[model samples]
Target: MSAGRHGRHEPVYRALELIANGLVRAQRLDLHVTGLENIPDTGGAVLCVNHTGYVDFLPLALGVQRAGRRTRFLIKSEVMDIGIMRFLVNHTRTVPVDRSRGAEAYRAALGRLREGYIVAVYPEATISRSFELKEFKSGAVRMAAEAGVPIIPAIVWGAHRQWTKGGARNMGRSRLPVHVRYGLPFTPGPDESPERETLRLRETMNSMLLEVQDSYGPHPPGEFWVPSRLGGAAPTPQEAAVIEADEALRKAEARAKRAADRARSRGSRR
Candidate 1:
């Protein structure tokens, strides 16, 4: 693995990295990481990653840390609202993205990249229940272009087996094998359209993802963590999309109900 110059260290970040890595080791996750040399040792870059499960970031960050760099992942602001999470996110200098005010998060990420930090982004925005690449958002490519940095595409496979949406958590000593692959970094051309570039990025990551899945071993038939196309019983992309839409609508209605209840309570007191 090629090493890059270490960026400025945050005591808290380093401590957390050690703890997380310790947990990973204890779990004995059979991690196979490749292409660490692709990560530049010293400058800014946007690390675009494919999201498969909730713990996907852990393995991806592990690989980045191996390259002598820490990742500032673009996490949703709601996660920052949690008590312990808030402290962790703040001290680790994670970029909190309020989806309702995404522009602010985008600008913050751009600033970090310009400051020579590796800003990691999940272009899919959410975990794919189908275990397949979802539609890509242009934000990652746009940020790289605007910040004048390279885009490094990365993929983590087999994380979903440990914990994922709609899947049972296996905190046991399953010793699952996780595969991480980082493709060579590339800079977007000044005149390239963001949409076109975003599509290319998605395609590249998708190809890498499939390659990792294929080489990871035979995906068992009817297994919950494997994609349906590969013989597992996981939802297809279309089925997962519908499930996600329903989940979103349900959450929106719940939020609206809570707002109305709060307003009623306030009026009664007045």
Candidate 2:
């Protein structure tokens, strides 16, 4: 196990880690991990992972644990509000972020990094409905730069097969394969702008993801969660854009109808 410079060792956190990691192992999911050596044995670093599904975070956490470190994730504030999830995340020392207030989240993450803890951020901000890397926001790069820690790009593919934002009715499959790969950490120059660094980070992550997919061979058929390149039913970015637009239009129409109905009721009363 790689030694962490200042990993958390609270009894409760350790207990939960054991249980959650045990659950992951019990799933008997096929997990292939690479670039384990790229993780520094001891230091505070920003771990930037591409989110694909509900269970994507676990695989990355397991890999980080295997490297002898603990990761505190910048998680959605909604999850922090759930009863059991709140308890678990609090014990895990995770940072909860109101998605709209990114600055607050960055400050919290910066505090963790200054304390020599690894902070994980999903730069894409959400699960990519298209099942491919999307444009990254600048938060991760900014956090790394401000904290003076290197950004470690970790890519996970195949977890979407088990569960994804679109659908997961096929999760009962006997065997699911998940690939997790970490990359060499790099620091942004002090003089470099966060925008440029973000672009570089995105490119690095995309290239690494492509390599992961190619090496994993073809994704099986009838799997809607798999990316299009792997011959699955996942949507492309353009397709996803149209789907989102249509959904938004439907929602707008619903809201307008409700408003009209309320207005008609008021007029009838008068």
Among these predictions, the greatest TM-score belongs to 1
Note the Cα lDDT for every prediction shown.
Answer: 0.89, 0.83
Index of the highest-lDDT prediction:
1
Write candidate 1's Cα lDDT for 1-270 as tens digits: 112355445778878888889989888999999999999988899999988888889999999989888888898899876899999888876899998899999999998888888989999999999989999999999999999999999989988899999999986678999999999899988899999999999989988987888789979898999899988889999999999999999999999999999999999999
All candidates: TM-score: 0.95, 0.85
List RMSD in Å for every model shown.
2.3, 4.5
Regions of candidate 1 where Cα sits further than 4 Å from its true position? 1-4
Clashing pairs in 2: none
Per-residue error at 127 for model 2, in Å? 0.8
Which residue pairs show backbone clashes in model 1? 4-41
- What is the per-residue lDDT of model 2 for residues 55-148, given as tens digits with 9 covering 90 to 100? 8988898788788778888877888768999988777678999857977877888988887888998888877888788889998888889888
